[model samples]
Target: MGVRLRTAMLAAALLVAGFALRAPFDQLRRYLIARCNDPVRLPRLAEESRVRFQPGARDCAARVAEMLPAALARIEQEQGRPFANPPTVAVYVSYEDYARAGGLGDASVAAVARSGYVLLSPTLCGDESERLAGVLAHELSHSHIFGWRRSWFAARPPSWFTEGLAVMVSGGGGAEGVDEAMAVRAMARGWAITIEDTGLWRDFGAIGFAAEPPPEIFGGDRFAGRQRLAYREAQMFVAWLRRIDPQGFARLLNRVENNESFKDSFVKIYGAGSSRRWSEFLAGVSR
Candidate 1:
């Protein structure tokens, strides 16, 4: 019995050590830094950009912060515009603790842009550096939209265009965890939501969204399915748009920044029946 107990204890000790080793390196480094530094506020800076936070599950701060400059460069390169001042990236430790950190609305949000700060939660996004970087870039896109808009009164573009652009630019777009074939198959079944404004429709048939969104897209029996399909459609559509119109995409983005409505900007490039063109492209590719 004594020998068995010793063996069990040794195994448990090793297991604990293994778990500790699996902890993210940045989290550990920040912990050590916080021990000697101030815990009330910890700031990590890269290329004069900043990530402000207190210690918690938010250890990916330094890596994400470092990614900002390069991400911004890519975003600016793609959009044909730049910002005079980049928004500060703020890292909140976790989703559940977001309110404790002074966030509003649902903590379930992965990230958000508000005022002078772009808030990111590692807990919501997992501690993976790449995922966090994507989240940062996406939120930065939101900031870029506002910054380049250059007008406080300009109505923002629809969520689909804005969020889709963010996803593609961050390299996180493309089928999201859903397979392209599956999406195409869903389209073939004719159960796909129609491409319309960002608000409506619950299905897609390889073609893009279509008109007259339901008064409410939520609360239906198919709400979850619809919402999921909506996001996939948005990302895929933006990617398709960029793919087809490359240089013209820059013009479209500029028009949006110049406060042109998404409808006008798209029509200006693809001409009338652009939505129909999306369907024709889908038909050619899916078959």
Candidate 2:
């Protein structure tokens, strides 16, 4: 009985250690994949430009290398700060490889931002050069946010702000299929993305969200069309906020990047809760 107990305890200890060490292990795995899988590093375009691509995808890699400087500069200009560190971009010719290398989000997503690197999908490398730039800029925006904030801060913002701000910065990359007119029509029909200044713990961990609309209504699957509409509405709302108060928008971005309370900073900057601001946005859309 004593030997059995010791064996069980040892097993449990090893299991716990694995769980504790998984993040760093996974991070290392991703870095290796980024470095090894994409063997061809393109010509240097800027101090921060380190783009890697597979041989089959050299043409796309060249495009990325060409556009990266302007894209990074544009994102920095819009976000009001420089990237804390240069992002290493890995462009893949296969969706399977991209997924294996820590790409999150649905397959339709063009690019995904990791902590210090980016994974670009094959579709974005095609003839859609315009879309390629937008998607690149969008992911870079996420990279900028990751630079300054804690890991948990990534999930702290309401999805609206996170996706919407990226959409706005990229000039409609994520919400490409839907436009302002279509989003307004959906809002008029009672389908709209909810705007909330989420608390630090709202969507973190296993805690259930306070009874809110369904996820599909918020950011749904690609086939349902709800996701695109939600993204578009979110972008429009963010744009409205900036247009109504440019200085206030800048201050809000500063506060958010500095790890301030999103809810408090928003109210302080705009003089009202998100609900009120949302209503004003709706009114403006109606007009």
Candidate 3:
């Protein structure tokens, strides 16, 4: 059987609260942002999306919408939850156009999840739908997390936990793939931060939104000296931990979402030995 197809689908911090978007948009920026974001509605795509376009990328929005069912299903299956609301999706022909139009940045950027919308760029979505699915799934994970965490506390999950889960769920070879390769090469050379190093976990608090947002906030070495590698390591750690103990994963996230400290939450579910387990996992990966 050919089967059926369906379609669907922030930022960090205020990206979580999404609606509180600092009104950083000036006349031109606001206009452009609104153009893509509040696009005139097109016919509904599959079960979820009503494709929207900003004259420049109608095809891009349609392309992503065409792939939404698989992406949403993956998120639901991985997270063990369904979305409370369908995410608003805006597609740009390429990242460069999106940045220029929205005052965001170049085509290197793929998508951003906001409180109410998922902004996408087809620039790197590749030629095939299958290739693009991973990116869609990854961005959708962020949207899902942003929505789910609000009921517990305003605070967002640590960068590692959030980004790690997104990468883990995405079948695409995202930054995690690069992170893994980098870790392996680094490990071979006997260079890796200890699992116990707190730096391994990203602190979102240190990021200052002094201006709209620089490229570093999205990805790069701006946060920590080893920030990129730390992200990869964090993804590996969290994903593996979840695999070994899903019940613990659920409980740990529940506690953390409600503002529990990572160590406290880890012990509450997996016993104090959880830290030992983490160190062991780290050693194996680095070895």
Candidate 4:
């Protein structure tokens, strides 16, 4: 064949391949955009959410309030108890202040004062107000589960379990879909990391906090990877437990919150004492 003809054929083939790839790419883009734009789905609260928005916080507290009842109901049903008190949600726009307060990303931070106030960052509030409500509902679950104890030691929820439970309760149980997808992707890529090694749950004293620089204290690549893994694994494990035994999982969470040992919790809930069950569950899902 002539060189000109050959080059033209090659270009034509490349164009066709590009066109073929476009459909999936577009689909993915649309999916992500939709997810981003969707309202934050939060679990309903027993009481109405009193959201106080900071400047430029995008006033959506009323919308968030409307969505809280359903989310709270789910948690109440799962735990078989009402929240100890009404929740006060505050939305902020300052990343610096949030970091100073020891927050990650745009997160719902529960107070240690037992006041039931949750600090939420606008960036993490999601595209619509509903999405923010969902995030708040998740945070509220942590608050309810832990009471006034802000210490990680107090919660002692396995990284996966706490996060998974939060995801499960948030958005009336639909947020689990996103949680599962992120988790399965992490598991398939062998990126899942144990939370113990990361020391993310460790409590830092005032002196210790002052001694370490902010950058040194907060952002480590290894730690970040592990944190991501923890969130993913927690979601996956929660989903697995729900699938295996919904009632048992709920009972197990309540038991654990009441200071049950991990082994005891597992035994009571799953009728097994070995971590092997978890490993098997992961392996099965990864397949």
Per-candidate TM vs. native?
0.66, 0.74, 0.64, 0.59
> In model 3, which range of ten residues has the least summed lDDT?
201-210
For model 4, the stretches where C-alpha displacement exceeds 4 angstroms are 1-49, 55-58, 100-115, 125-130, 148-155, 171-182, 195-229
Candidate 2 residues lying further than 4 Å off, grouped into runs, are 1-49, 103-106, 127-130, 151-155, 199-221
By TM-score, the best candidate is 2
Name the lDDT value of residue 102 in candidate 1: 28
Count of backbone clashes, every candidate in sequence = 12, 0, 6, 16
lDDT of 1 by residue, 7-125 (tens): 99999999998876654554445344433433235455443446676475345666666677898898787667786466777676655444333233346456666555676755534
Ranking by TM-score: 2, 1, 3, 4
Local accuracy by lDDT, each model: 0.60, 0.72, 0.57, 0.53
Report the poorest 10 consecutive residues by lDDT, candidate 1. 198-207
Score candidate 3 by TM-score against the native.
0.64
Compare candidates 2 and 4 on TM-score and give the better one.
Answer: 2
Tens-place lDDT digits, model 2, residues 96-151: 77765542324555677875777788888764555788788888887887666765
- Model 3: CA > 4 A from native: 1-48, 94-97, 100-107, 125-131, 151-153, 176-182, 188-231, 256-263, 272-278
lDDT of 3: 0.57
lDDT of 4 at 138: 74
